[model samples]
Target: MKERETWKNGKEFLFSCIGVSVGLGNIWRFPYICYRNGGGAFLVPYFLFLAMVGIPQLLLQFSYPQYSSSGPAKAWVCCPLFKGIGYAMILTNSAVAIYYNVIIAWTLYYLVNCFTLHLPWSSCDNIWNTENCYSRTYGLASMTGNTSSYNTSIPEDQNLKTNVTLSSNDSKTATEEFWTYNVLQLTDGIETMGTLRWQLLLCNFSVCVIVFLCVFKGIKLSGKIMYVAATVPYLFLTILLVRGLTLDGALMGLRYYFIPRWAELLRPSVWFDAASQVMYSLGFGTADHIILASHNKFHHNMYRDAMIVPVVDAFTSLFSGCVIFVTLGYMSSTFQLDIDKVVTDGPGIAFMVFPEALSTLPFSQIWSTLFFLTLLMVGLDSRIVQVQVLTGSLGDLCPGLFRSRVSWTSAGVCLVAFVLGVPFVYQGGMYVLQLVDWYIASVAFLLIVLLESSVLAWLYGSHRLSEDIAVMIGYPIPKFWQVFWRFITPCCILVVWVMGLVKHKPVTFGGQAYPAWSVGVGWIISLVPLMPLIGNIILTLLKHEGNTMQRLQKSIKPLPEWTKNLRSDQNSEQNGDILL
Candidate 1:
């Protein structure tokens, strides 16, 4: 028996994986990185990384979990020696999901408020007129429930730069162009409204309820929901793209987005950024994707769909960048601000800059409604996937605890997740967004990709892996994947990882301090997968009689499915029983 699926079937599985993979990262990170890295120049390393590291690592992530019928922790049981790495992924999945879902809830909050035609942060004294709240006044509240002065700094033009007068006898001025500058409302950093703690709590709770409703059934239900949720955002985004591009400043935005700096295309850091984006956006090396996809039927061509997901994701990202830059150009021209101030990406881009832009548009209320509603719907799938990964991990690891005997196991998990989310419902939930994102989504993910690729490509023998892929595909994989997986791909990931280490610095922001313990914790967090690798090497090198080392050192046998078809052909002269 296949046992209870605890989720959906093939198509639903694919949709769910796509749903998680195509979330906020595509809309928020892709375009900005593309803009800053090298515009069209960014595409080169992106495609290369997708083919080599991105797609291959994705394949590995799905294949292991699906075959093992395990969650993050048990998926690598064949290498139980490194199961801690899987545990790390589980911890990340849970921690990130809690905070990430809070952000989704914030989107829902904004979407709901848009129906009120509220321009709560319009910075205009005339705001709250509802008819022209663009002209209204608003107040800021701090976390301790204190009020702060508010300003209506609606920019008159979006593409202006700040200048400092030279303190010289002749009163001459000199400008040094820094990379942080952008095209609109061109301030360097925009902090969240720290005084809005109550609003933040309301927003976080609102989205949490929606996510709870969507995910209560896991992937099967969420998959069908995502068919709409995942597709709707693109429709709205496309509308924005077409409308924004047709607007007077669209070309200016396009020029800003794609005008490649040849020198920038050569930077090693650019490739690293592009690689990281692909990893995150494609759900490469993510246990979350595997758990969702484990529900795919044995016969599904998920590998082909896997290829399609990244390509489709990349297209959406580029499309969004064009749209974002166009609107940014308009904002810049309107407010006399530079693009850099207006073009921040990731969480801040979605939560703040885009909302600020919407506050400036004609029929701003309607546009705000469309924009946030689309994001709410689009992001729901992602939040659901994260929750499902959590439940799936818990369910698989202790089946009786969450399975038939424990009817409320699912509810227990949802409660735990909700509880985990409470601390983040602060005034600066967006700051919580960035902090959790860095901790749960960044360095840990990179370590897994590097470790998994090294094991699969170099240690496991890619030639045999290619043969298995050919068998499943019913056609030989293109020579490109074979060579890419074996050498080019793994090498690229290693280079990126090493370079990141070289470039890494202790993180600090806004003159706030992180303790020495916090810094040590961060380093410990980064070396998560490698910590076990030391033991694996020791096990392999030690020689002893009847030792766990010998048993642990043995390479995994190929699954029965891999060899059965070959034996089926030779059965005329051979024993079928042995094969069975």
Candidate 2:
């Protein structure tokens, strides 16, 4: 077999992992989840779950690739029956990648418009605006201290101190109209996939080209790019936070973000949301981190990398909350609305609320450009890593076909992913995006994480994994990690998954639930990725020449080659030839 490529140093691997961890979700998803769960009170469960669930699973994922010197799929030599765990990882990440770039395309379209003297979404006079459209900027400029005509019963004694007038019940802000009409060109339902939006198609194609160029040369070039792509978003966040703090109601938003609702800690859903957020923001149970660590030098300190990456991810999510809520707080104070009134869920916070907030700022065009640029960079960082995961996995699985042609592998994956993503740029694409994201990214992802934890900690053996980590890092894992890996993490994941399933509602957009047919399609999208696990089990049982129980026991045993490289390293360590 040809030698697998390794990173020049551990720093490259760390940065690559961090780039994937601190993705667009930290900016858009985490803040809203944080605020909704408990305002400031949510941190209790968030950090609790992070410690109990996130770090342990991260170590498990990190350890396998580092020890095996292979991608997620190929690393499963430890327990070949569970190799399907790796397949599930790849499929889930691939499903995410398909629709994710369309978001980057949306950001690209917005970034281009940011260069204009006047922002397109600033007024109601745009061609996309309807008779019900009311300009948020116009309202902001026209009514300073004037009381809003919109009916509200909240007393003036409240914390926000609402005094300004708001648009009526029927009014949609220019920001809203632009997002729904101009950018998305949204149809009423998923059944009506209208004509392609040529502008967005071109933008999505550009995203594909950019991703291809960055990754086609392999990790050396991409690793160098991470030096910038991984860290620059921090600079943008700091800038936005500083600017947001200066606004009148910025403190109000900050309070909403950090102030703990102690009572919320009693809610099962609050804890579940926190656990799920840790999984989402930290990029757990994904192939990208495995591929990233697989490139590290054999003796590199992944225990440290695992620790630092999750910390940075959590900090970025917290910092982004400051940036988002302060702007939200300002919007509330400006429009004399409560914080809850101003806040929105899902992508609305990114494409609508934040854009409207930026429009209210002085030098709105400059700020808008910076914000979308941040989104573009963060989204691109994640996209490159996802491509790396797919390409690297294919190379690992079929070295002969891809061994000398890594670039070709990358190009083909990017081309195929881009083509699949094209449907998202259609007029009704947002609906399809919502449907796929709801099913493919949610429950299926939880199941993948649960399966990995069980197989690695139980089936493959936690004590063995700890010994493997000690081999690479020069020390054994703490008892806490071992205990959590074998028991606590799995229990927490099961509770969260079950609770989420019980509370689950049909996926909806703009207050409208998807049709029954579309819901079925969503289920199929989620279920197809999980088929490998069942199929592999039946195959393993049939292939082994033994009784059912004996076959099951034999299937879980490590292959002879599983620790071949590790034994060589152990011998070298005993000879004092290998040093950590």
Candidate 3:
């Protein structure tokens, strides 16, 4: 067997874990989610779901690797039947890594444009702008946010509107136009991929190159890089917060962002959103954490690191929300628009909203550069770790083939991911990106996470695993945590998963639902991760020589090898010394 790699120090492991958790979503998605779900009131459910689902799953991700001495895909020695859970994680994360870089490409394209004396997206003067393109000023005169508006709250309504909608009658904002026409050069639908946007292709290639360099060798170098990669976004966010708070109407935006809507707590969707946000924020289901944490030493204190990473991830979301709302408020005040007109989530907040909002500032070029750079860093942080997860898992799964060939494995993964991402640079690629993201990252992800918890807490025995963690970390896992892992967490996940399926709507982009053929394609994409699990089940039943109950008992039984390292570490701890 090949020797597994370890981090030089715990800090690299911590930063890499942070990078995995905090990504583009923290900056562009969370603030809007919080605002829409009831602002300050949303935290109640968010943290509740975090405690119930996020933290328990996270501890498992961190501890499991140390227990097995393996990466995610190879860590299923205790229950080979559920080894598919690990493969499913790699598959889903690989699919995510493909389109995710396209987003980084978009950010890079905008970053390059930021060198201009005038912001390109700030007006309707570009060749890409059609007659329907309207600047922010077009509907500013009549816009208001009051009770008369639908879903309007003076400090509560996140989707506020007025007589003149921000984009209506087939109109688009300058920023929206730039995003659609210039940045994306979007086609009518997924059916018409239109032509390749060479500029975007170049940007995507650049991102692939950056990722390849950072992680090609292994975590030894990548771990050092993460020290800077993980923390630099915070610095930029702090700077933006200072500037945003000083802007006119910043207080109003903050008010709209943070004020509690007590009634929203009564709605089920708010809780759902909170739970989903926690999952999204920490990447509970992805196995990125498990793969990353596998690089830590056996005796490393993952419990402390796990808690720190999640707190930092949550804090970063709140901090980024403050900065986003501050600038959004400034935009609202300056343009006489409602807060709802300015608020948006997902890629829209970063691409359509912030570009325009930053353009209104004095040093538009500098601020634009700063903001996009921040996007680049955060996106890179997440992507590099994702790449590491893929490469490392492959090495662990096929050590005989890849143990000594890390660079080749990393190159192969990056090249394939880049090739897969080529379609996203096409004019119609945004539709495909959204479709893949909606299915692959949504329902299938939830299911994979659910399976992981069920397999560990029930099949492998949560109590035994907790004792293993105690041997490694020098503390027994709390009873509540075991309860959560065994009972509460699984129930909550099942409920949320059911709710998600029940509330499922056909995926749509802009205002148009995808064509039937494309929606069919989406369902196929959603099923990609589950294939491994199903196959493993059939193989387990077929290969294990026994009746149904006997086969089940044998499959869940831990292999003697699983105890080899655990016993060694326990012995070391029982003595006067522990392995460093």
Candidate with maximal lDDT: 3
Write down the RMSD of all candidates, one decimal each: 8.3, 7.0, 7.1
- TM-scores vs. true structure, each candidate: 0.79, 0.93, 0.93
Q: Give the per-residue lDDT digits (tens) of candidate 3, residues 27-94.
A: 99899999999999999999898888888889988888877778878888788888888888888889
Q: List the residue pairs that clash in candidate 2.
A: 40-258, 40-259, 40-260, 41-259, 41-260, 41-261, 148-165
Model 3 RMSD, rounded to 1 decimal: 7.1
Predicted candidate 1 versus true structure: per-residue lDDT over 308-410, tens digit per residue = 7777778878877877888888777766677776787666677666767667677778777777776777677787777777677777777666644322555
Q: Candidate 1: where are CA atoms >4 Å away?
A: 6-9, 126-196, 405-407, 428-433, 441-443, 510-517, 524-549, 555-580
- Candidate 3 stretches with Cα past 4 Å from truth are 137-168, 567-577
Q: How accurate is candidate 1 locally (lDDT)?
A: 0.61
- Lowest lDDT 10-residue stretch of candidate 3: 153-162
Task: Look at candidate 3 and give me any clashing residue pairs.
Answer: none
* Backbone clashes counted, model 3: 0
